[model samples]
Target: MNKSELEKEINEASERIKTRQSEIETEIDRLGEQISKFTNWAWIFVWIGAFVSAFALIYFICTNTEKGFGLNLLGDFMAGTVASVWSLAGLFFIYVAFLGQKQQLLNQQLEIMYSQLEVKYTRLELSGQKAEMAEQNKTLRRQRFENTFFQLLSNHQEIVNGIDLKRVRDGSWTTSAEGRDCFSTFYERAFPKGFRLRKHPIEPTVEKYAEFYKVNQSDLGHYFRHMYHILKFIKKSKELTKEEKYNYSNLLRALLSSYELLFIFYNGLSEAGKPKLKQLLEEFSMLKNMDFELLINIEHKKEYKEIAFASSEERKKLLRTKK
Candidate 1:
């Protein structure tokens, strides 16, 4: 009970109190960490429960239940202040489901678009093939026409080369002196006069020419037949293009040579042969259809003009004499 003994006892009690206070603080910190971990785990349970309740609500509606039993159960489990949080979680799940359905609809539309593209491409390919086939057929027909034209050229070699009437004077009518003199006059007159043959002659002028010459009729029949065949071939081929007409005209021009006026005046065989040949020549003479004025220009050239007539006056006089 002295003063020193009382001070020693109070100091020891103060040390013990300080140690107990530190231990209590450390235990409080550990408890706080455990409570935080439990709170995080409780959030997982809340999300799982919310999703299950939403799915149950959907199932009940689908099954046509009389009462909203699943919704009632959810309300009982998550009541008071926390019910609004659970409702928001259910709405979030519904929004996610809507997004999934929208994506499915977009995928279906894309597939339809792809199918349409494939069908369109196939149709285009078929159309191209048909066009190619049509072009090939056209080419074949054109080739056939060209081949037939070439064969026609080969068949009529003599009349196409031109007949020298002067050389054909050994016939029966030219045996007598009077016949020979008449034939000589006819031969000289026939050149420029025969060049004026009609494009649309109604009758064969072979009989008239032969009578004028006092010669055999057969002497001029070959020439008329040759010209007739050429015209017949042209008229029959109604599908001839302007180019083909021009080409055949050039061939006829070659046969006629300096006798450019022959086509304008020559009479051929048969009534059927007359007007058709006339119309064909008229078509050739057209400015739009052909460059036939060039043929006239060719005839007017020095060499052709000199061979047909020595002078324009002589030509006019000879034409007048014939008329």
Candidate 2:
């Protein structure tokens, strides 16, 4: 059964056990009351028996003691009768004492049962407290994770804002672009318009990316490294599920401008990003929102896995069509 149904069953069983315990206690009380009444009646019987026996002995002595009855004989008869009566009364007292001891033992057993029940209830309460504490700890962990995640996101945006590019002209530098505009300027410079296709496009592409990266390493290096760490942070988190990691990565992806995505696409193929950053890019599907039309060569898309550019649903559809 599911958790709720199982819990319901356990609760019902506990209630049944409690009800049975109560019934047993009630029965013990009733038995105790009967025993008390019987003991009281036994005491009355003992007293009545002693009184009747005394009266009979006195009547016999008065009626049967005639002329020539010896004093010694009469004294012997009275002693024997008194001894028998005392013996009978002593037996009745022993039985009454036994009943009293039995009642005491029963009371002790009831007390022990009550104590055991109290301990079980205390254990159950402690278990509930532990579960509540565990839930609170989980909530705190989630809050801490989200705080760090959003802070890193904000830092990434700040880094993007600080980016700028200057073009060299006649021994002087002029600011050619700033912020997001710098990415487009870098892309145009790296991949000139109407460039002839190389025999091996991959090598030439990497060379172009390396050269462009060297020229603007200071600005681009920090941006790429920060972006890579952001994604890497999400990937390394043990707290997040696969879907949660994907959603967080998508949130970071949403902040990137089209030119920024274009720059990232080529960056991942270059030497600087191939080892670690490229894998993280594909894992998080970082290029899922890239505009294919922006690429200098559309065939460059084939270098990465299909998952890098397509969403899960789109990938599934592609798979079905291939099949």
Candidate 3:
């Protein structure tokens, strides 16, 4: 049974035991009164019998009609009467003693029962305390994971805010863009109009993206690395369930503009992100919300696995199918 139900049962049992104990005590008290009354009556009977025997002996001595009535006869009569009276009193005392012993035995049995009940109650109370501690520990673990998770999220935002890109025209810098706007410039530089007009092999596309990325590595490298670490942190946490991880990753995904997703989509195809980031993207469905029309070549959307863009239910169905 659950803790509350068990505790309630114990409380009810305790009440019953207390009531029984009170009843036993009252019965012992009543027996004591009965024993006291029996002793008093036994003493009164002994005194009355002694008085009658003495009066008969005195009367016999005073009204002796025969000279043969002697002291020996009177002595025998007195001895027999006194012995009988004392024997009756002794039997009454013995019966009272038997009742007293019976009451003591009942009290002893009750005490033993009470001790056993106390032991069971103590054990149950300790079990309840252990259960409470386990729940508290679980709560504390979740709080710690959330604290670090949100901190990483905040750091990711700072990196995004720090990004800046400048456009140069006629050998002089003309315009500048910052934050989420910078990814559009990065995407345009990496995939120009002529590059998208003709169908290109995957290797050449990767190589071309790599060359453009090399030129802008100074601004892009740290941003991608930090982003990778954030996803990695969520993946490595043992405290989070699959659903919890998905929710947190979706929060990170929400921060990215469409251009940011485009950049990430291409980045995943390169050698830099292939080893780990690509798999993480699929695992979290990071591209589920990507704007497919924004890609330089719409067909590029098919390059990654379906899991990268599948909804949570779709991912589950895919997993079951695989199994």
Off by over 4 Å in 3: 1-128, 167-175
At residue 304, what lDDT does model 3 achieve? 85
How does each model score on TM-score? Answer: 0.33, 0.55, 0.57
Winning model by lDDT: 3
By TM-score, the better pick of 1 and 3 is 3
Order by lDDT, highest first = 3, 2, 1
lDDT of 3 by residue, 1-323 (tens): 66676667667776787788778868877987788888887888788778878786887788676666666777777677876787788888888888889878877766666666555556565776666544544554565567567767876887888788767889987659888888888877888878867767567778888998899898889889999998998999887888889899999998999888888888898998988899999989999889877665667777788989999889888878878
- Higher-ranked by lDDT: 2 or 3: 3
Whose TM-score is greatest here? Answer: 3
Higher-lDDT candidate of 1 and 3: 3
- Residues 49-91, model 2: lDDT tens digits: 5775677567666866464456565567556775565566666
Q: Which 10-residue window in model 3 sums to the lowest lDDT? A: 132-141
lDDT (tens digit, per residue) of candidate 1 on 15-100? 55345435543554454455445455556656766776676567667754665467666456456324655555555555545544
- Where model 1 places Cα greater than 4 Å from the true spot, the runs are 1-128, 160-219, 268-273, 286-323
Give the Cα lDDT of each candidate.
Answer: 0.44, 0.73, 0.79
